[model samples]
Target: MNGGPRLFSILRQGPYLIASIHTALDDSQLVRFQQDLVERIGSDRARGVVIDVAALDVLDSFASRTLRDIGEMARLRGAVTVIVGIQPDVAFAMVELGMDTGRVVTALDLEEGLAELDTYAAAPPAPRR
Candidate 1:
């Protein structure tokens, strides 16, 4: 169980699920969030997931890695994860600290995040070679 306030909130939006994280997540909260996220993705059959981290005051190395890990785990369960709402300072800090969320797409805000998912959904399947 998370010792602090809930680390994240998951909301279902059409075929996509939006997970918005609260500020200042410790290691335990991150683990719990991942487990709960996996359960939600499977139960909801989410085609895409948007992680809104706009609320966080800062994005440290641990949180950055955890977000990427969560995205990868969701991907394994058949969801394309997009991380959105990274503050300007956080982005600068992430670069300075050498932190990267590998392979996780991102957007400027929630609206753009939803649009990204919708665009992907609207695309026709690639024709077989």
Candidate 2:
């Protein structure tokens, strides 16, 4: 995580913590990526995460599961995880593989995903007495 163009970039915009995944995510790198994310979230308490997957082309079962796990883990840490840039064919194939992406918010592109995260960030926090 210290070099190699950064598997993911952690950006802090106001109250939102965005993690943009710029490299090709695979089984070999997914675990390290997740560990990095966990550390970031633990430190920042980010309200939302935007995973930019535009650079990825082929996603196997392990990658898909990693994504799903990322989403769930982010949620457990109180951050919303949104996956962006998933191509149509890849999405279709993921569905065929029964990858439960239902928990992960998805966007066609980074801009849209960031916008969605903005909305989530802007929403009023739950009432706390």
Candidate 3:
């Protein structure tokens, strides 16, 4: 397997990786996406990730959970994951479904998401306990 998704792409932009989902993806593809994303973050030494799902019309519970998991995994790699471009309808549906994003940050668009990454990058690291 190429460890890549056909329905979406993970493009590198400096210290961030942008996962742009232009269309819906099946469960298997989502898994591949999760794996590929984490791997790329390490291989590319990315400081952050932005998952853009604006083009998606529907975001189901499983997909939402998978996204949350990806965010958590990325964080473990010392990278911040921000999800952007969630459509209004899909955002409502996620709220109605009671889906939570956990520690993942969200923004309205790519520019905002990148700004979030910049802010996080500029912030000092959490002091060790």
Candidate 4:
């Protein structure tokens, strides 16, 4: 993707990739966003993907589904995905609209999201003695 105006920003934070959406995205930007995320994940090989959507006030069905899809794709690429920063209104709207995020995990904020992702990335607990 061109380095033009980006709808979102992706930063490599340790073993996790944090993608924060800064604005309301149109359909085209959404597509570009997906492509960019895929490229970033592929190149970085991050252990987890944390998407911070605190700035986004509106979470439409399309956007929600796209995020879910992205999370699934990230997992396929060997990285767990955690979506954080969901607004109260957006959460209510999503529930009222019956928009499901499938298996995508969610957290209250970036810190919590990263914590959850770490759990996913960490090695499993040892067997019982």
TM-score of each: 0.89, 0.81, 0.94, 0.90
lDDT: the better of candidates 3 and 4 = 3
Which lDDT tens digits does candidate 1 get at residues 1-129? Answer: 358566679999989999989776788888787888878999999999999999987988888898899889987887888999999999998999899889989999999999988887788755666
The 10 consecutive residues of candidate 2 with the worst lDDT sum are: 1-10
Q: Which residue segments of model 1 deviate by more than 4 Å?
A: 1-5, 124-129
Question: RMSD, each candidate, Å?
Answer: 2.4, 2.8, 2.2, 3.5
Please write out the lDDT profile of model 4 over residues 45-96, one tens digit for every residue: 7889998889999999889989998998897787889999999999999999
CA lDDT of each prediction against the hidden true structure: 0.87, 0.78, 0.92, 0.88
Sort by TM-score, top down from the best? 3, 4, 1, 2
Clashes of 2: 0
State in Å the error of residue 58, model 2.
1.0
**Best candidate (score: lDDT):** 3
> How many angstroms is residue 120 displaced in model 2 relative to the true structure, after the best TM-score fit?
2.7
Query: Over 4 Å off in model 3, which ranges?
Result: 1-5
Model 2, 1-129: lDDT tens per residue? Answer: 555567767787665666666777667678888888777877887878887777777677888788889889888888888888887777788788877576788988878888888887779876666
**What CA RMSD would candidate 1 show?**
2.4
Minimal lDDT window, size 10, model 1: 1-10
Best by TM-score: 3
Provide the global lDDT of candidate 3 against the true structure: 0.92
Please give the range of 10 consecutive residues that has the lowest summed lDDT in model 3.
Answer: 1-10
